[model samples]
Target chain A: MFEHLHAGLLAAVSMSNLIALFFGTFVGIVVGILPGLGPMVGMVVLLPFSFAFSPDVALSLLLGVFCGGYFGGAVPAVLLRTPGVPSSLVTSFDGYPLTQKGEAQTALSAALLGSFGGGVISVVILIFLAPALAHVAASFGPPEYFAVAVFGVVLVVMAFREQFARGIMLLGLGFWFSTVGIDGTTLSERFCFGTLSMQNGLDIVPICLGLFGIGQTLILVERDIMKTNDIKLSRSTLDFSAIVKVLKYWKTLIRSGVIGTFVGLLPGTGSILASFLSYDVAKRLSKEKERFGKGTPEGCLASEAGNNAVPAGAMIPLLTLGIPGDALSAVLLGVFTINGIYPGPLLLVKEPVLISTIYISMLLINVVAFLMLIIWLRPFAMIVKVPGKLLAVVIMVISMIGIYAVNTRLFDAGVAIAMGVLGYILLRMGWPVVTLIMGVVLGEIMENRLRETLSLGDGSLGILFQRPICIFLIVLTSLIILIPFVLDIRKNIRNKKLNQF
Target chain B: MPKKDYYSSRAHDLLGSIFGVFALSMLITSPWQVDTSGPDPFYKGPLIFPLIVFCLMLAGSLPSLWRLFRPSEKSSWYLDGQGKPFKTMVILGLLIIYLAGIIFIGLEVSTWLFLLIALKLVNQDSILKLTLIPVLVTLILFVIFKYFLDIWFPEPLIMEIFLE
Candidate 1:
């Protein structure tokens, strides 16, 4: 391990790789700080260039973006009450409150420090645990894969417990969308409705840009962007004391990091879930729970730490099983495939040095991005003062161009605009758009794996229950689904008893 | 009951039922033809997942539809803040126009025009700043996407005529 780290360090320090890392991190920060444009869009925009660069350089660039984007989102969340990325929504629950209380500098410092710590811890886990996890993943077959995919869908539904029905409905909608293209086995089109472009199926790029980017822009427009009050930043600098103040929440940081890494290991469960779960856990465990949404440093620490850890955790499934743990990692899979670096169990065996270099690069990216953000903290705070109308125009233009640039197809731009309209309607109707996107991401995998499992079993459904791993996953999924209901029942009974007394 | 409360109360169920009808139509109109010659003929069809999904959609919508007819707590129908309907309509209309313009006039010109119009609608800023900002931003984006990344934007009919 030490020897591998040494080799990785040497490779990562190369001039070209260093330059890629710097630029990737810079683009990531810019994309993340801008509302509605998350790391996924940034990576997608840069994906075409990955074909021109070496695998190490390409991977470094994307990883830098992935890391920097997660931390960069906290800037707007803390200062402007607008989350640059969905994962930072939880951060703003406390971060924006801190800003309102004239503690924006403290909140920013805490978030950055928490992000750095979580990033480092997650990398250490990746370095030590990924190889062993890959070994276990190597033993998995179609039935196990099918079970894990089912577990992912269920976990996503569970994440939106308050809106379970809406989540499930959106998931169904996503599944329907996934079935549009030519079937892998039969080559028969499912739901193209006679349109030739529909036969190619909907691309994730347009869906993301439409739902997250354009949809968000429309909502912002309705909110009257020009009328929003400018946020005033406190005059205090993020000094040594602020750093020390954040370090006091070390326990929250570490716990959130662990939770994030584990949740991130699940296929299709993304960083948003990890952050929300960590925030919930932190609030539940804190003695001063009443202070949770009211400018508590611990709350910000938990959310920032959890979200920043997700990219490393997501790498586990992508590297070991060739399956992406989340949408962002799914895009990374495309980058890997384009660069002729197929990620599977053999990837580690064939390119151990390259993988190690990626790990080293991620570690370096976290530190470099943190320092750069701290140096430019004041400037970023001032970005919130930019008129919302200008921001909306820029976002709309970028989203349109970015979607069109993917395949140079006007039809894709149409698809994006259509999805944007649908997304806005769904948002107004109180539906969860993330679930729909997740369903689309996981649907193909589930269908392919289920078909494979059935073929292996000669059409016997019993085979799915026969494997120990499959059974374990089934039981786990059942528990995840049922526990909330049981808890609800217990609460109801207790309330009734108290009323009788 | 107030008109807003009445609409808000029925919105979820109305939307759910509409979605259910759409799902049913999709399931019924599925175009996948099963390959009976294959060894696993039944499993080879592409419509199985879609069928399951549509069924789930119908199932999920049923409860909401049922609740619509039953007495329920009052809910606000207005999703956005009051007096913003005009702004919402204009923004959506602008988006639709932008999409059409992209196909008709090309991405660069349409994007520039869209930005100017959208900014004018939302802000009282000087015409120069709006024009310059959009022009500058568009040129920068065009260079980065076209020259650096090698993305090809479709040429408008006017440009093609001029070139010819």
Candidate 2:
């Protein structure tokens, strides 16, 4: 394994791959800091380019985007009081407040250093642990995959803190949307409705862009009035002392990284869940819990660690089961397929070098992003100083061109427009687009897995629980779904009694 | 009831009615087809999920509908000092119009035109800044799609003549 790592490191750090790494990380940072354009959109826009390069080069670029994008989310969260992605929502809690108090550099430096620490820890874990995880994942069958999918749906319910009915409704809607394309076994189309585009079902990318980017942008556009009474950021940022302070918070980093890795390993549990859970955990464990929302550095560390650690953690499942762990991983899976490499347990044995190469590349990607963040730190801060309207126009133009550049299909452009509008409406109604997009992204894979599991029996229900892994997952998912509701009910009951006095 | 409660109830009812209408529409317009293949449980297996979703939608919407007709005691809604919900509604309305235009005029033209109109209506900026920024942006997008990324967009009818 050490020998393989040496070889992989040599191959990954070749001049060309390094250049790709730098370029990809730079693009990712820009995309991450820009509102509405998250890593998935960046990946999709760059997916077609993957076809033009070797699989390793492709991974380098996209992985760079994935890693850099996670850290990039902190930029806006700190400076503009806007979270570039849902995962960065926790960042803004303390981040924006810190910015208001004229310590933007301090907040930014802490987030950057925290991101690097959590990311490096997870990468080490990914390196040593991914191979073993692959061994465990090798035992998984269709039933196990289905169970995992079930677990994912349950996690979505927990992660989404909105109305229970609405979340369930969205899940049902996602399942329905998943069934749009052709059936797995029989060469039959279910809801094609005679449209060629619908036959392929909905592409998760356009739908996601429409929902998060377009929809959120419209909401921002509508509520265009600036809310911040004052905007001030100290440009003279010092890192060494700040780094020392953050290093003392290793317990926070480790806890958040573990939480992030666990969430990432779970199919469909993305960084948003990790960050929120980490923030909640940090708050629960902190000495100064009351200071959390009012600009605590611990809050910054937790949120940054939570979001940045996700990509590495998410890569575990994708490399192991070929079941993408998140939206970005799904696109990466597409890149692997396009390159004629199917990622699964077999991939560990057949392409051990490839696996190690990716791990090593991820390590380098973070380093490159760290360096780029340092070089571009001041410019990034200046980015927020631009008027909101100007920023919107720039994002709009980029989105249009990016979408057009990818497929060049007018139909796809139309699809994006439709999706954007639908997304905007869903946002206005307070519907969680993450759940909807998760459904769209994982719909086909889950359906195929479900069909495979169902076919394994004499059509008996016993097949779903026959596998020990499946049974364990089934139990886990059931607990995930019920625990929150039970807690909420208990809290309500206790509160009612307390108020009665 | 207080006058504020009367308006709030009306708003709740309107929301409930909208969902109720949408739910009903799904039941009516869901392209339910007959599967003529072997041992069909119902004529339409495809319709099952949609029908289930519609039923759930109707059921879920009931609380909002009930609140519209009868005031609820358990809930409280807050308003800020200067916030006018009606103004927010109008802004939302303008956004809907801008989104609708994306479908008709295409993304570039629609977005550019929307920004111009939005700036004019909202007094967000001077005409010079608003007008110049849109075209500059449109060109940047054109270069990105056409040159940088090699994405092909259907030139808007206005640009179609000149570019072609």
Question: Each prediction's TM-score against the native?
Answer: 0.85, 0.78
Runs in model 2 deviating more than 4 A are A1-11, A14-20, A31-62, A75-107, A225-256, A266-299, A322-354, A496-501, B1-31, B34-132, B148-164
Where does candidate 1 clash, by residue pair?
none
User: What clash pairs does model 2 have?
Assistant: A405-B151
lDDT of 1 at A43: 74
Mark the regions of model 1 whose C-alpha exceeds 4 Å error after superposition: A1-20, A31-65, A76-107, A225-256, A266-303, A321-354, A493-501, B1-9, B31-40, B69-86, B160-164
Summed backbone clashes in each candidate are 0, 1
What lDDT does model 2 reach? 0.68
Predicted candidate 1 versus true structure: per-residue lDDT over A1-501, tens digit per residue: 678878989999999999999999987887788775568667755654555678899889988888989988998898887887889999999998998888887888888887888888888888888899777877888898788778867876777776677678888998877777677677776666677898788877677667666776776666643223465555534566787877878889899998888878876567888899999999999977999999988888999899899999989877876667666786676667646677767787788898899899999999888987877776755655566657666777777777777678878888888888877777666576767877776677778887788778887768988899999989999999999999999999999999999
Candidate 1 overall Cα lDDT vs. reference? 0.78
DockQ of 1: 0.50
